[model samples]
Target: MEQRNGRRLILLPLPLQGHMNPMLELANILYFKGFSITIIHTSFNSLNPSTHPHFTYHLISDNLSESEAVEKDLLLLISHLNRKCYEPFRECFASLVSDASKEPVACLISDPVFDFTQSVAESLKIPRIMLRTGSASFTAVISAFPLLQGKGYIPKLDSRLGEPVTEFSPLRVKDLPVINSSDPERFFKLVHNLTYQTKASYGFIFNTFEDLEQHALATLRKEFHIPIFPIGPFHKCVPATTSTSRFLSQDWSCISWLNTQAQKSVIYVSFGSIATLDEAQFLEIAWGLANSKQPFLWVVRPGSISGSDWLEPLPSGFHETLNGRGHIVKWAPQKEVLAHQSVGVFWTHSGWNSTLESICEGVPMICTPFFGDQMLNARYASDVWEVGLHLENGLERGEIERAIRSLMMEKKGDQMRDRLSKIKEKANICLRQGGSSYQSLNDLVDHILSLESLALIKHD
Candidate 1:
């Protein structure tokens, strides 16, 4: 191992909340280990560096500015950012390298989605480490892109949506991320390019523990030549001493409301930052909560429902009917909400971060996955881990009511809670001194120090 020195590391995170959180968490881990951190972010979904004052921040130009009229489609948004980020990033990187007085840039830790960073790092002779924000199972699926493409699964058609992907067992065709695009071929090409980018990097850092996704991580190690580090449920590893939000202000009032409620009574609901539901679905969800007769805390973010900046009025007489039984907010402090004794159930979109946090808190989930790795995460939660239940069928009021009831007041829900407790225990064990995450984190820092030493030797 190289001797400890104050080295600089530049991080490029995909400009989305889900992607940014884990990257920032990783930066926090490295910063504590004596690395000077510089975050190069894009204007679109830009992070407020003031929250992390210890790290230097640079803003690069992006095609999708916060003030500009942006594309509504997720694929189009991603396409624009990927195409626009390269030039600005290159210029900013050059400036960083030219400065000699500051600690030299030792390595570039990039979100796996941003492949262009790999090329820029290589050109600048900086080692690049890829950070995968999703679960190991999802990464395993993504890492097998070549095989999927060869088997004609890349541009999956509507007819084949229900078929099982035999090569990747337990991952049905429906679980595969399907981009809603007019240009399906272009979408497939974009996915293929992004996923393959990780293979070119020096190593990988996954926000997962060893026991949680052992098989998937094992497969990834077998397939890739580089070192793989599983150091996460990151929020637990390093406490969030600083706020890290670009948007979506959190409402803490719900915490008080949760305190007033009975233990194991309130069902906490959130669909994450990006997913938008139509009017019908929104009403169904509202009616379901109301009909379930369970005290609930729901996050109905601005623009959560399609075609409106705010949720269209819920089912008529819904608020009056609930009276003081339900609490609604634009956003809630999710980790705290899950940790509360009153929050017995989590009705979530099954985003990786939310799933992991729920697991850490031992809160069973009612998963209604939206897109991307969520489908796979939901599968792991419900089927593999047996810590959650999948909300089957479309978003109907009756189905939603039934699912909530099943998860909150039934024997199955108790079993899920028990399993979740075990999972939480495992996560705690892995994060302890000399545990899986603890050892992986130490190894990651050692690897980073070695890179710094190599860079210094080359410069000398």
Candidate 2:
């Protein structure tokens, strides 16, 4: 570990699993670069501090009721957090600033969803940088929301779902991000706040590399007019270690099972931490995997299947149909599983982290996006990148089985793997010393250090 520089950088992460993992990974990266780390988090879905012993942890009440704590509507929960966290965060931040013994504070880094942080950082005269946890292409789509809405494209008409979003090539009307709420205005308001506040930050940090998203990055730089760093594949930038950010315990036994399977023969299925399926849809997936007639390792997160506790709703003789061909776990070490030689295909929800991880490992995907930027990511994977197949229709066992065979037991799958191998090589090259990501990381550190001088100028 690099020696601490006695300058602390504070990070506030959104409480969701996908959001928290990247933030914590970035925290670890910066810590290894020699800055002291402090994490300010909400009491709901609180992180275990012992897991990240190197960092200082602070908790602020989110004012969520027991029911609200288990709220399925993500937008409402985020709105509540924005409204309630402002005062507590201000107080907590003030206390941190006034402490005489701690290192001089450098700047505040936070997930862009917490738009409230921009005002708080301004009030305290602290520089704030926003870390975008999604793809640059998705950010481009978000930045164009007003235009898309003005053009009467949003609140997407079911009739137009298959029509092209002319402005966003290859993206159809249904590929736009969505909220699962009765009030559409609420989602728009949140988007407006997120986009407006992020533009006010000192700089934007994305967990993507230039080679993978050159055009999107170019568009973003022109729009935001702030320093943009595309330093990513963050997990690859650092050594693999036990992650402190997981909400579910990983079942390592799956690795041993993968070991027994033939090379590039096991299909790995996981839909990320969120994204639920009804019992009927869940049954379709279970049967689909069985019907694929290939060895598979599936991560069926507890509570992810609606109206069922764990695997209670699994159909009769589901295991016998597989005849020891499938392995089911509540969770598995996803990166390790992806890197395993026996793993050939990833059936995913196209969550950005999972997408990038699959790309890094040269694994082709079968995308069944649930919501938000997932649809857009899935479109890019299947339509643009040609590294995955998109199951645009709702789940059915026959369709699932065919999609599986096309990727796992056919020439189409070989073509996807070939394309992904090239993309994967580009990802690896960008991490080397002279690579775009390597240089961007250095620039990011320099930018953080320069904030101290900017602060000194303000004080003087």
Candidate 3:
């Protein structure tokens, strides 16, 4: 596209914090490549002060009346994305495309959840790409969902002789792979919807690099014709540039605590924004951390533990024992903490964001996934990437302690660390000049620009 003609782009992100965070990165990458981007958000999400805050922030209603209704319409939530988010976006794009200050909007890049976007792109006859925003292992899991029965993992939904969900991928229902859905049934429905949408997208943009996920990458290339571009380590693509805070990214105070720790000495534990533990779970995790006796930073979100008086009261003496050895805060600047020299390991919920962050930092993981495809992501992180340990499915203080201790001093920990360190080098390389991610990112930009150019040609 000629520089004077202007190239305009439309971006749509999932409403959740975890979902919006990566899409924003992709947008920044597009802007750097010289396309004007208009990102669409949900009314539900833009109001949440805690989630990522980027894009022009246009919102749609998911439109479920109650928690029960949301459950029933779970697939709708996952795949349908609100139609209301679209009209405004369409109007915005039309205006921007015609504006004297900007180029005509040519392409649409959206999250799969926002399916209504496809129609908008179609109405304008513009190419729209979906952001996959997950790991290669995760992509493999989704691609292989129908084949899970051949290997005998999860029971077949339709056939008795079918393979289990575990056969095609390393994730399982038992340990760290599930989404901690708060409602398992609802969670599964959401997964089903996302898988279907993958097939629906014109193409997908991933926030990962090729070196970090060779097997998954190879599988996506070999098995699916769906266009999957790995243009990532998106955080690396950004130059530590600051914008107005979109979502309250954890507590900033944790940064000071991290600064004081010794190199590779502290374990960082956080279960993400939505995964809450109960009193029993909380006590188990607390006691486990105490037993490890390793320095750590733990984020304890209010009401993080379910059914607990513990929210109002810290475990007696826990603060005393943990004071110098560890620090507890509601949230922290996670990426910055992950980058710290003292972050020896991570205890996480295995959310995609957490998984990717740990990978970027080269820190080993202790995965205690709560729901979604977490079990699958963790499986790949531990068994595939060799970057982590997956705690037992039903969590225990002793199990958590044992896992932490193993991660800290055990031979397996050392092996995994060395392995992850090598992988980390690859991630760095991928984001560097002429690297896989860098190249892929450029390709994505060129593709979007090509679409915008076509739109301009059509207009002319």
Candidate 4:
């Protein structure tokens, strides 16, 4: 083990699987780079400190009721957390700053969703950096939210759904980001908060690489006027560790099943932790996979199906129809699964983490975006990157089967696979010593160290 530096970084992660995974991975990366880490997390989805024994941990009460904790409305839940966690986080952060025995605090790194952290860090005169756990393309679109709203492009009128957003070429109005909020005003507020708070950060650390999103990164740099570090595909950058930041236990049995299947023959399906499906749509997907006649590994997260606890809503003899062609589990080891030779197509919700994982592994995707940046990610994968197909017309069995055949058994799929192979090569090269991500990471480390000096200058 390397000796730690005298500086410590405080990380505040929003308590969701996608958000937590990248934050923890970045923590590990910084720790290996010789900085001490302190993780201040919420009680809602608290991390197990034992999982990362090297890091110090602090749990600040979010004070959420059982109902608030289980609130299905994502925007509402986040609003609740922001309002509830502000005071507790401020107090906890103050204690860390005033503590005598710990290393001299360097800076604070937090998930951008916790916009409250900016004010807390400002109040303490701490330099704060934000870790944007999404694609640069998504961030660029988000930067345009106010303009989109002003033009009445938001609230997504049916008439404009298919019309291209001329400003954001290749993206239709329907492809714009949206939340499941009945209150458009609240959604707008959330967007404004996320965007401006990001601008307020000392710098940004994106979990993306330059080659993949050079255009988007350029746009963000011009807009935000902050030092932006596109130093990611974070899993590839970090040394492998035993501890997992996953909220659910991964079913490793799928790996065993993959071993028995033919190479590049199986379509691995997962919609991430938060996306849910109605039973009618779920049945369409089930029948679609069956009719595709391709071997598949599907992750049906316990409560992901509407009005059904698990897979009880599956039509009778659903398993027998496939007869060992399909494997279903509550959760999957996604990175491992995507890297498996048998997985040629990833049928996904197009979350940034899953999209990057698939890209790095050279697996093509079938995008079914549920909400938020997923729409943007799916659009980029299908139209921009040409790495996947987008299920544009919602869930239909016939279209699903056709898309599977086109991607699995046709020339178009082969072309997508070929393009993804080259993109994956770029992703790997960027992590090498002379690569963009490598240099960006070096710059980020230097910037982090310089924050102490910047603080002194401000004090004087």
Per-candidate Cα lDDT values, in order, are 0.85, 0.90, 0.69, 0.91
Per-residue lDDT tens digits for candidate 3, residues 1-460, read 2142266677777766677778777776666666665655555546443333333444544453455333423344554345445666667655554567755666678777665666666666677777886666776675565465355444323343223344454444342233433455654554566666666555677877777776678877776676678987878777576331234446777778878888888999988866767677777777888878888899887656766533454566777876688788877788888998889999998888789889878899998876666776777778777788888556787788788888888898889888888888888888888998878876776666576565555446
C-alpha RMSD values across all candidates: 2.5, 1.4, 4.4, 1.2
Model 2 lDDT tens row, 1-460: 7788888999999999999999998898889889999999999888999888889999999998888888788888888888888889899988897788999888999998887898788778888889999999999888899999898888799888898999889999999988776667888887787789778888889999998889899999999898999989989876566364878889999999999999999999999998999999999999999988999999999999988878999877889889899999999999999999999999999999999999999899999999989999999999988998999889999999999999998999999999999999999999899999989988988899888777566546
Score residue 108 of candidate 3 by CA lDDT. Answer: 73
The C-alpha stretches of model 4 lying farther than 4 A from their native spots are 458-460
C-alpha lDDT (0 to 100) for residue 381 of candidate 1: 88
- Sorted on lDDT, best first, the list reads 4, 2, 1, 3
What lDDT is reached at residue 285 by model 4? Answer: 96
List the candidate 2 regions with Cα displacement exceeding 4 Å: 455-460
Instruction: Judge candidate 1 against the unseen true structure and give its global Cα lDDT, from 0 to 1.
Output: 0.85
- Determine the backbone clash count of candidate 4: 0
2 or 3, which is superior by lDDT?
2
Stronger candidate by lDDT (1 vs 3): 1
Q: How accurate is candidate 2 locally (lDDT)?
A: 0.90
lDDT value, residue 89 of candidate 2 = 89
Q: Residue 386 in model 3: shift from native, Å?
A: 1.6
RMSD of 2: 1.4
> Residue 277 error for model 2, in Å?
0.7
Cα-based TM-score, every candidate: 0.95, 0.97, 0.84, 0.98
